[model samples]
Target: MGTNVTVSLKALLLAGLVVIALAVAYLVGDSRGTPAEAASGGGETGSSAKRSVTVGGTGEVTAVPDQLGFSLEVRIIRPDLQDSLDESGAAMDRVLAELADHGVTEKDVRTTGLSTEPIYDRSRNAPTTLRGYRVVQRAQVLVPKLEDGGAAIAAAVRSGGTAVRVDGIALSVADPEALLAEAREAAVDEARAKAEEYAAAGGQELGEVLTLREVSPTYAGEESWSEASLSRSYASDMALPIQAGEQELAVQVEVVWRLAD
Candidate 1:
């Protein structure tokens, strides 16, 4: 009887150990499978959440220019460098005096360029020889009043004589910051409107902006007068036919929006 009882007690202890081992194995398998199940669920959620659209839009505004800008150059040639420089300087002084007389202030006149170089005489059967020195000086003038540009050019030419050359002319607004701001606002509005359209077409409601970026603004239809067109002879009393046409300023933007129910 004593032996049988001892054997039964040993059997019960072995059964308890086997049950504990099985429980540990089941717990380990469950812990490992939970992460895989959660990852699969997360991937499905992420795929469904990534619903968005991107669009681009542009805006433009036009306005007339308020100011005129041009450059004038005086060039002279002489056998001596000093004489060439002196002649060019005197011519520039006369041109400045003329511009001042025509209501252009000293602050508006700026010396943009100056250069002196040797004139080489290259001819057949003749070795390269230095003929004389040439001196060139250029000034950029800004006329506040649009009507004064032609008169100023004519005066400069008369004072500087045949050596004077009108380089180029351009029309511009005095202040462009306000115009740029307006264009930016318009661009954003256009982008939002386009995004909404896209969302509606896709049977989704526009939720929130995911991202926004601005493309560099562009300007079109700005008038630039060519040198050849304005170089023709003009009388002192006659005004050069200058027409300040409209200038178009344009801005563009890119935006991304998320879609919702």
Candidate 2:
């Protein structure tokens, strides 16, 4: 009887201790909360924790073009392929010499095209008869000084005679590093201004910039003069009249800012 009573008492004490330990564990867990709750800042929502605004701005810089590009071609046809090639080559040589004398460097003159093709007769009575051979030589010249572009072109045409064809003339900015930097600064300033305005409208303070990215820039007024237009505008004896007009470079940027309370 006595041994059974002692065994019962020991079992009751062990069960009581386990219940007290479980109650303590429950109290501690309730105070600390779950891992998910802690990660969510104890009840803060995602939207309230992170607030931001994105804006885009554009900036443009204009300056006169300082460089000129010329696309020149020399074409000739003859009864023999060798004769056609020789004539085309000689005309191109004379044009290149004239360009060099007019301050164009050797490196700036590049041969872009050289071809010899057989001319075909398309008469209804004959079946694609070979009439003659046509040879073409083309070069691109870069004139550093925009003012000398007309003189250089005229000299080349005079030396190459009627065989020389002025395909195109393009004007561009030779060095745009400083211009690009200034444009970028202006773009960022515009973006920040927009962000601040938006923040004020939303009744929030503008915080630090979270992200910034530059989009592809836009260039305006880089016109290419066509061959037909050139011929119509200028006479054979006169130098080609070129105007170095203003060109604009634009930069666009996207900025993201975190909104503060």
Candidate 3:
């Protein structure tokens, strides 16, 4: 009887010690976990405390255009669709040949549009009657030599006669990659200077760049001259003169800079 009683007492003591150990472990874990959670929250707050400013700047560069682009069309109106097509096709052939004679290669000329539509006679009382069919063949020509543009246009008109129509001519740079790079560099420099000005005004200094994004570049000073007036003048046996103006390439960028005390 005495041995069994002693064994029961030892078992109760062991169980109590186990329960106390578990409680102590849980308390220690909870104490450490609370501070960890607080530290994580404090980190988030610190991140939010960072200061930054955003600014935009623009830069522009102007250069003379080296390339000229123009559109020409040969149109014909006839009672028969086949006749209209034949006439327009012959006229276009002559126009292309004339352009070739003036140093405009076949690759430089591209057919932009070809369509046939019915012309309506609006003089009818009740319903409009079909007058004829009109066929138009349009092409765009790129003149690498700006000086040859006038002669190129004049040649096309002479080849196609009154049926040839010059839409318009625009001047632009053949390769704008270098110009764009210069504009971008200028834009970044302007942005940095503005950022510094602002930081100094606000009693802060500029730190590292937080973000940088370039806005899509834009082109200005692209002058397009209509050939309608010039065509009339050409009919009077006057010389056709073409003037290529300068083109302005502009670039803008938005930058975000961190501020330091």
Candidate 4:
């Protein structure tokens, strides 16, 4: 009996020790291995690793401006400032009438500048005598047909509104929003090419695009348009020379790409 009891006690103690050891291992494993397992995708396999680079590029596009903006002005000189202003108004009224006669719509004709300044005979500064008054008024004409542009100016000049002067002729795309999109796409393509080149230089192929952005659209105006404006002369029946040249667009992209091995 004593031998059997001793054997039973030994077995029980062994079993208890095994259970306590398992409990302690479970607690320690939960504390240390939780973060490592989660970071490793909570499985035996690990998650994908990423590497990347950034690059910059510039792009430009040239296109003829499709629309034109021209202005007509009438300046009158008189002995008195008010008188010059009145005469100037009368001339502009006549000009508008002529434009209406030529099928010009009210929307197409808009009055711009109206001002009266005292003319000073500074040539002989003998007390700065007021020679006369100069009254000037301006109007903008939106001409759709490039061919009719000259004829319209000639008609204004012959109408005795001889102060008929052109202010400026600006060229622009009619549908800027739509046309800018194509230019932006081109800019993006250029940027991608540059990125590829940069990636090759760094010994890595570009991976998935991390980010994309658009900077802003820009314009290049004709240089002569401004030069012709300052000179005071009516645009005659002679065809106005206009060259729109080109417009520029830009896009910026920050692409974080995984470098290839």
**Candidate 2, position 46, lDDT:** 52
- Collision pairs in model 3: none
Which residue pairs of candidate 1 clash? none
lDDT string for model 4 (1-261, tens) is: 999999999999999999999999999887656565655433333334344565554456566565566778888999988788788888888877766665567888877778878887775546778889998888788765444554455566656445767656666656666656666676667767877887888787777777666565577663333425332234444434555566544444444444554
Among all candidates shown, the one with the greatest lDDT: 2
Off by over 4 Å in 3: 1-48, 125-129, 226-228, 236-239
**Which regions of candidate 2 deviate over 4 angstroms?**
1-48, 224-236
Residue-level lDDT of model 3, residues 10-91, one tens digit each, is 9999999999999999998766655545554432334344577899989889988877788888899999899999999999
lDDT of 1 by residue, 1-261 (tens): 999999999999999999999999999876665554555443234435457788888878887787777888999999999999999999999998988876788898888889999999999998999999999998898878777777777777777777888766777777877998898889889988988998898888897888989888776544555555445534334556678788888889898888885
Steric collisions counted per model: 0, 0, 0, 0
The models' CA-based lDDT, in order, is 0.80, 0.84, 0.84, 0.65
Better of 3 and 4 by lDDT: 3
Q: Any idea how many clashes model 2 has?
A: 0
Instruction: Please give the lDDT score for candidate 2.
Output: 0.84
lDDT-superior candidate, 2 or 4: 2
TM-scores of the candidates are: 0.74, 0.76, 0.76, 0.60
